[model samples]
Target chain A: DTAVSQTPKYLVTQMGNDKSIKCEQNLGHDTMYWYKQDSKKFLKIMFSYNNKELIINETVPNRFSPKSPDKAHLNLHINSLELGDSAVYFCASSQDVWGVSSYNSPLHFGNGTRLTVT
Target chain B: SQQGEEDPQALSIQEGENATMNCSYKTSINNLQWYRQNSGRGLVHLILIRSNEREKHSGRLRVTLDTSKKSSSLLITASRAADTASYFCATDHLYGNKLVFGAGTILRVKS
Candidate 1:
């Protein structure tokens, strides 16, 4: 099984439409994160969840929300999507709180969901 | 803001040759890591070198971190076509758990 798997590998929707991307990790990690990669390949952090608790939230649009139901899953929902929202979203996980497991914690990332808002 | 900036946005090499890519960061970091992402695939961790460490090696990969210079480099020796992919450098903020990535370097290895 994939260590980290995300659904809807390719998403295409019109502006004003709402969409959601689902992510799950079987690595039994305590920390999960959502990152957005633009066309230029600039990867930016959107949100991070440590053990189902919100730990990091970047300056993203309010229309975007992250929900972590359990330690193993983190999902991202976007409302009133705009053209700028078109980017590849990646799901990732680490063994634990990064600083706590500093040396050995390298992220495991999902293949990524390519979302497009026309 | 993107914490690290990768030089030579793209690289091309032939099999058996060595490929080197460098990354520079703006803030102090606890550790620096290298990752590879193949076309249409997820990123895979390559190696991690702690701030206190200078050099680390794994198989065909070698990573060096110079905290003083706030720079790191990844060297892939005896490169194979299969090693072709986008390589990125990621660093953790010295004080927090936040990990930031750089604009990746696309590596093309020809056989």
Candidate 2:
């Protein structure tokens, strides 16, 4: 079973279009996060949800929104996608907020969703 | 904006050699973690060292953290071709639930 999984590993859409990426975690984690990896391979945190509550919201554009239906699922919706949004979107989960578990408390990431805006 | 920055954007080494990667970050962190990504695949967590701990090891991977210097290093002994991948260091700040990642280091192990 996958610890964290995302749907539509690859997505291609025209500009001004809307898209959504779904994520689920089976590891029974309390905190889930969304990250964006740019062409430079720099990973940045976009949003974090703890038990369905928004905890961390970075400087990402308002066009991107994260919705957590439950502790096990977190979905990202982008409105009027732009060319700059073409990057790999990753979903990750951690057992606790501070990662107090040490070595075994690392985040579990899903295979990223590669989004392309034409 | 507590981002970890990894040095040597890319590295190349022959098989059976040792590979070492370094990461430095700004601000205090609760823990530092290292991850490996195989091409387009998802990142796999390699190791994590807490602020209270100085060193840790798993298999062929060794991680050392220097909280005073806000730096950490990952060393892989007896590197093999299969170990070719992108390595990233992430830091969890003391106040947040997010992990800020660094610009990864792409390691290439030639046979």
Candidate 3:
């Protein structure tokens, strides 16, 4: 079974359209994250949730919002998407949120959602 | 801002050859991790080396971390055609839950 899974592996939408991507982890991890990989393959953290609590929110635009309904799921909702939002979005999870014991707690990532705005 | 920067944005090698990628970060970290991403796919965790460790090995992969220099290197020996993918280095900082990732190094192994 896939430890982490994201729905809508590929998404294409016109500009100004809103979209949402869903992520779920069966690894029983406490922390989940959302990352965006741009055309240049630069991956950047957008948000993180620890046990359904917002833990990390980068300086991403207001259009991007992350919601965790429960410990096992985190979803991303983008409003009025722009052309620059075209990229691959990945969902990842880890057993712990602290880095103290993180050496052994590597992240497990989902296959990713490819979003393209025309 | 990117937490780490990987050298050689792209690398091409023949099968059976060794491929090495270097990563340099700007902050103190508790551990550094290596992840692999195939085209249009989610990343796969490869290995992690703690800040206190200088070197680590797993199967055909070797990872080195230098805390003082804030740098790390990943070596994949006897690369296979299937090994062709983008490799990324990520850092887990001492204070945050987020793992900062570097711009990936794309490796193409020709058979």
Task: Point out the worst 10-residue segment of candidate 1 chain A by lDDT.
Answer: A96-105
lDDT of each: 0.91, 0.92, 0.90
- Here the TM-score of candidate 1's chain B is 0.96
What TM-score describes the B chain of model 3? 0.96
lDDT of 2 by residue, A1-118 (tens): 9889999899999999999999999999998999999999988889988899998898999999999999999999999999999999999998886544433267899999999999
| Model 3 Cα lDDT, one tens digit per residue, A1-118 | 8899999899999999999999999999999999998888888889989899997898999999999999999999999999999999999999877544645378899999999999
Kindly indicate the candidate among 1 and 3 with the higher DockQ.
1
Instruction: Write the number of the candidate with greater DockQ, choosing between 2 and 3.
Output: 3
Instruction: For each candidate, give its TM-score against the true structure.
Output: 0.96, 0.95, 0.95
Candidate chain B TM-scores, in order: 0.96, 0.98, 0.96
TM-score leader: 1
Candidate 3's DockQ is 0.72
Rank list by DockQ: 1, 3, 2
| Cα-based lDDT at residue B30, candidate 3 | 82
Q: List, residue by residue over B34-105, the lDDT tens digit for candidate 2.
A: 999999998999988889999999999999999999999999999999999999999888765567889999
Q: Output the chain A TM-score of model 2.
A: 0.94
Give per-residue lDDT, candidate 1, residue A83: 97
